[model samples]
Target: MSIWWSLHLRREAASVPLARRLLLGTMETAGVDPDVSYDLSVALSEACANAVEHGGDLHSGGASQAYRVTAYLDGEKCRIEVADSGPGFPAPGPGSAVRRGAVPGAAVPAVTAESGRGLCLIEQLADHVQVSNRPGHGVVVCFDKILKWREGALLRVS
Candidate 1:
């Protein structure tokens, strides 16, 4: 069986939890393993939070902008994507840590830093992560995880 959903949400703090809850509920209903669900939820939250915080037009005031979150569960993996309308990431340089669809060897934010840790966390939690920019459009954070099902999952894969 396969399951998928998408949500377009305002870039607000409250929307973060709402998205997380929806993903968690979906995972629960599909009988995904609790730990796997938790990891994905957290990753989702981080991505949502990033979008809410940075996915906006600074000159126009970002609060009024919106972002999108999409989730897909098929075969043995689950994929989630968060796309925001804020200014996309700056063009990467030769030594830049971020690439087209992955952030291999990305640096972790300093302990005292209040931000910049979400991407690393997402990369760590999800089996594969892609952080890309749409130039004058926005940024998209996409990640995928291998799913594990409960013994009697409602949508168990054979």
Candidate 2:
């Protein structure tokens, strides 16, 4: 069986934990290995935290700006995607704090003296990570992790 869930959250600090808790609970109930669950949870928190901190023009709409988190589980793999309606990352350059995650083949920048390390951390934790941005819209961070279930039986999705 496959399980999937999505959340539309206000770009607030509290929403980060709420998303983390739900992901943790879902993974736990699905029998995902504790270590793997913890890793993913931390990664998810980082992703959500990035969203909350830089996901959008939080002060522009006065409450309408938001981000989205989606997750999917099937068999031995779980994938999560975090997207926000922010003004995408700043252009990449010599002194730019943003990055080249826009193109699918864009190499994830090496950890340098830059301020943003969220993407680097996500890449290290998840089995695979992909980030893309929509011009004049926002950015999306998608990642997946390998899962080891406690039981070999078919897992059901509630």
Candidate 3:
């Protein structure tokens, strides 16, 4: 029995708490352990913050500026995707200076007092993080975590 949940909301600061509650509830309903729930909540909070801050101008009128969150539990793995309607910036490369504390490409500057770090935390928390621009739209951030499922326990069907 797999559990899944999704939400589409306006990109407002007020929506952060709502997103957090949604994730927490989903995690609890999916049988995630308490410790795992804490970790997931932290990761989800960070992701939502990034979306609200850098995703786009949520104050602008229309649906193009909304934020979306989707989550699902598939056996021992949980997947979450957060997307926002904004012009997406290029994420740092695998070995970029941002990752190595060196310098990025010739056009990009070294890590200074202004930027770098969000992705680092996200990488550490989630088993996997994927970022991409939605075609003709905005940006999407996908996160996945592996849950330790106890053996011999039957999954609840809902």
Task: Report RMSD (Å) for each prediction in the order shown.
Answer: 3.1, 3.7, 4.9
lDDT (10s digit) by residue, model 3, range 13-129: 888888888877776665677666667777777777777787776666676567898888887788888888776665556665533311123124445845445555667788888
Cα lDDT computed for each candidate against the true fold: 0.85, 0.80, 0.70
Clash pairs, model 2 backbone? none
Candidate 1 per-residue lDDT over residues 8-53, each given as its tens digit: 8988799999999999999999999999999999999999998888
How does residue 134 of candidate 1 score in lDDT?
A: 72
Q: Per-residue alpha-carbon lDDT of model 2 for 1-158, expressed as tens digits?
A: 88899999999899999999999999888888788888898999998998898877777984337889999988779999999878776655665344444243334555574645677778888998888877567888899998877664347333
Q: Specify the highest-TM-score model's number.
A: 1
Output the worst ten-in-a-row residue range by lDDT, candidate 1: 99-108
Q: What's the alpha carbon RMSD for model 2?
A: 3.7
- Which candidate has the highest lDDT of all? 1
Q: List the residue pairs that clash in candidate 1.
A: none
TM-score of each: 0.86, 0.83, 0.76
**TM-score of candidate 1 relative to the true fold:** 0.86
